[model samples]
Target: MTQRYSVLLWLTGGLVVLFLIAPILAIMPLSFNSEPFFTYPMPGLSLRWYEEFFTSNVWLMSLKNSLIVAVCATILATFLGTLAAIGLARKECPVRGLIMAILISPMIVPIVVSAVGIYYAFAAVGLLNSLTGLILAHTALGAPFVLITVSASLAGFDYNLMRAAANLGARPHTATLQIMLPMIAPGVFSGALFAFATSFDEVVVALFLTGSEERTLPKQMWSGVREQLSPTIAAVATMLILLSTLLLIVMLWLQNRAEKQKQRLEG
Candidate 1:
């Protein structure tokens, strides 16, 4: 009975994985579809849509903008979130719980609520529709993800090593760079991946805050998706899937490395 149950569980898990991957995989062949419409089992297979995606200035520009925004947001959120996580994890900090709550509140709050507030705030500051404004908003949303990942890593972190580093004449920054950052780097990198994914996939806030000039990939896709359903967007989706897969691989590697580090520390 137990063996039978185990087999059943495996089958169920496989089904779930297939379900999740189906839509993404569907986009792949659809991109090569000779039909302009978004459908499969094409009369012929061609790279026409792929060519369109690459050649179209609007699509190419949006892709560039998305990459820039994701990179910038990832860096900013990872730096700030890693620092904040370290501070929060230290025992000497006062009101650490409160600080952590405040840091993560953005994640808990409804995105629409936050979007409205940011829209108004950016509008007032004359930052609406600007790259900087979009970056700032995405960074704010992405930081909580960084904080969550880094804090998880720090949960198993050693503090005595930090003390030893300090005693060995290492300055605070030096100790952080050599000891702390290395120890927690997997978590930091995982956090950065999440931040990049969040910023890259985000659309609602971008919709509200962005203008024609500063449109990200999702925004461009959104506008085009409504006017006419085309296979070009499917091509973009496949690219996004590939990018997401790469990031996921990076995150998994980091997580496995972190686990090994934890085992070493514990041993």
Candidate 2:
């Protein structure tokens, strides 16, 4: 009976995986279709759409904007969030619980609601329809993920090591940079990936905050969906999928490296 149950569970899991992945797999071939439409059984496979995606000025500009915003947001979020997490991990930190809730509230609140609120707030401050505004908003949305990851990394951290560093005449900042940051690097990097992904793919906030000039890749894709409905969007999607897969591979590698480092440290 147990063996039968185990086999059934395995089959169910495999089916679930297939169900989730099949749609994404289906889209790849459509990107290569020689025709403009998204129909199945392509008449021929061609790189026409890929060529269009690369050659189009609009798509290229949007891609550049996305990279700029994502990279800036990720860097800011990682730095600020790492500091916040380190502070919270300290035993003497005041109002840790309340601070944590406030820090992570952006992730909790509904995205549309946050966008609306940001829209109004930015308008008041004249931050609307600008790359700087968009980057700041993305940083707000992404910092919580960084905080969570770094906090988890700091959970088993050793305060005694900091004291030892101090006793050895190292300054607090020096100890943190030299000793603590190195140990928590995996978490910082993982959080950075999450921040970059969030900033890169965020559409709702982009729609609310940006003008056409500042549009990111997702915004451009949304525009293409509404206005053009071209096969170039499919090619862009395929490229994004490839990029996501690369990021996932890097994350897995980081996780494995972190585990080995942890073991070595513990040993």
Candidate 3:
């Protein structure tokens, strides 16, 4: 009975995987379809959509804006998140739970609620429809991911190492930069990568905060889909899938490296 159940579980899991991947897999080949609309079996294969995606200034400009926002958000989120993680890892802080809850509150709050609040706030500050404003908004939303990853890494960290460095007359800042930073580098990198991905893919806040000049790739794709169901979006989606897969592989490598380093240090 147990063996039968295990086989059943494996089969069920396989179906779930297929369910999740089938739609995404459908997009790639459909992008190559010569059909004017989204459909199966291209009248013929062509790269016209991809070519359009590359050459169109609207699409290209949105891609550039997305990259800029992602990069800026990654930097800000990583810095702020890493610092918060380090501060929390110190046992001396009172009300650490409260602090952590506050830090991660953004993740728990509904995106729509946050978006509404941010929209009004940015409008008041004249940050609405601006790239800098979009970047800042994304950074705020993405920071929680970085904080979670770094905090998980630091949970296994040895405080004794910090004490040793301090005892050796290394200043706190020096110890952090030279020792702690190196030790947690993998987590930091993974966190930053995740931040970049989150910012790159985000749409809700972008819809609220951005305009024609600052519209991200996702927002542009969204509008295209709404207006005319362009198959060029399928091509863009395929590219995003490829990009996300590459980032995922990098994140997995960083995680594995961090685990190995942790073992070596602990051993």
Query: In lDDT terms, which candidate is top?
Result: 2
* Tens-digit lDDT string for candidate 3 (1-267): 999999999999999999999999888898998877787667889899999999999999999999999999999999999999999887898899999998888889999999999999999999998999999999998898899999989988887888999999999999999988888889999999999999999999999998888889999999998998988999999999999999999999999999999899879
lDDT of 1: 0.90
Q: Cα deviation in Å at residue 175, candidate 3?
A: 0.3
lDDT of 1 by residue, 11-113 (tens): 9999999999887777788888888876556788888888998999999899889988989988999989988998888889999999999999889999899
Q: Give the Å error, residue 2, model 1.
A: 0.6
Q: Count the backbone clashes (under 3 Å) in each candidate.
A: 0, 0, 0
RMSD to true structure for each model, in Å:
1.4, 1.1, 1.2
lDDT leaderboard ranking = 2, 3, 1
The TM-score between candidate 2 and the true structure equals 0.97
Model 2: worst 10 consecutive residues (lDDT sum): 151-160
Q: What C-alpha lDDT values do all the predictions have?
A: 0.90, 0.93, 0.92
**Which regions of candidate 2 are displaced past 4 Å?**
none
Candidate 1, residue 207: the lDDT equals 93
Estimated TM-score for each candidate: 0.95, 0.97, 0.97
